[model samples]
Target: MIYLQLFLSFFQVGLFSFGGGYAAVPLIQNQIVETHHWLELSQFADLVTIAEMTPGPIAINSATFVGQQVAGLPGAILCTLGCILPSFILVLMLSCLYMKYRSMKAMQGILAGLRPAIVAMIAGAGMSILLLALFQGALSHIRLGNFRVVECMLFLVSLFLLRRYRISPIAVIFGSGIVGTLIYTLLPV
Candidate 1:
């Protein structure tokens, strides 16, 4: 029963998540965090972090992590399979259709129209993650003192490095970790 539930839950995630990994974050969050109540909000954030840090797609990674957390190894397998099935079928069908209709004006217009919706989904997910990180997932009742000062500074610095110097994101990620650790270590707690 648990395996079935896991499979169906993630199957829905895979079926409806149109834009990509980041765009699926909210959907994944809704299924795993809100609907199932399988994980706390903070844990979901950590799952996102782990998903991002690891290789492969975020939705798949999230399914595996959440499934494992909820119901161990079999759950992970079912969830992973569920998450992959839709995309596999979708890509195959879409590829065939796209090849056939590559020059169609309506097809191109449909594709172009989807771009902004995808961007909105990605931006919404990013903002949610940022707020979660800044407030330590306590977004319901934000107060000035609840903000993590170090995290804000780290965010600013990371943005600066990305925007100003065009540093590789990998370098920026590791650099932020090192700087964050040093700053936290030296600061009075």
Candidate 2:
């Protein structure tokens, strides 16, 4: 019963979560943290962090993580299959429709309309993650003075390197991890 529930919960996530993985963050949160009560907000934030750091889509990674946490290996398989099913089917169907209507003005207009919505969803997700990171996973702790100066500086420097030098994101991520580990390990945070 629990495994089935887990599958359905993530199935809902995969079905309704449009605009890719970043945009799916809130929907995934709603399913796992809010609706199902499978994980608390801080745990959800940690799961998101882990999902982002690992390979593959964030939503799929999150499904696997949550499933493993909830009901172990079998749960992971069910949840992952559930999460992937809708995307697999939808993409197959949509590819056919898209090919058939490749030059239609209506299709172009629909695509144009969707672009802003996707951008808004991604921005919203980014802001929520930023708030959680800055506040240390608790919104109640939010204050002007609570910002981690070193962490914020690290983010800024990483962004600068990526934009200015066109460094690979994977390199920036690994470099940031090493820097953060060294800093936190050496100094008292």
Candidate 3:
């Protein structure tokens, strides 16, 4: 029964979440934090961090983490499969139709309209992460004022390294974790 519930919950999430992984953040927040109580807001924030830093889509990582937390490895597997089914089915169905219609002016216009929506979703996800990170004091949560300065610096540095140096994301993740751990231990909040 628990497994079934986990599968169904994630399936619903999968069915409706659009605009890819970042877009799913608000929905997951509602489902897991507000409706289901599977995790607290803080935990959801941590999950987002883990999801972002890990490989694969953010939504899948979230589902797997939540499922594992709720009911272990089997639950994680079921939830991941359930969450992915809608995308798999829809893409398979749409591939034929899309191939036919992709070049149509009206379809192109519709897709153009979707670009802003996707941007908004990505922005929302970024905001969620920023809030969570600040709240946890992980990303320069302390300052007499202008605490965001630290966050901005880190963000710029990360962006520069990623864009210019083409550093692998996995390397960044591991480096950040080690650095954050050391910071947490050495510094007193």
Q: Pick the candidate with the highest TM-score.
A: 1
Q: Write the per-residue lDDT of candidate 3 for residues 38-133, one digit (tens) a residue.
A: 898778888998898888999999999999999999989998998999999988988988899998999889889989988998898787677656
Q: Who wins the lDDT comparison?
A: 1
Better of 2 and 3 by TM-score: 2
lDDT of 1: 0.90
How accurate locally, in lDDT, is each candidate? 0.90, 0.89, 0.81
Candidate 1 residue spans exceeding 4 A from truth: 185-188
Can you list the residue pairs that collide in candidate 1? none
Clash number for each model: 0, 0, 0
Pairs that collide, model 2 = none
Give me candidate 3's TM-score against the actual structure: 0.81
TM-score of each: 0.93, 0.90, 0.81
Cα lDDT of model 2 by residue, 36-135, tens digit: 8999888988899889999999999999999999999999998899898999999999999999998999999999999999899999989888787666
Clash number for model 1? 0
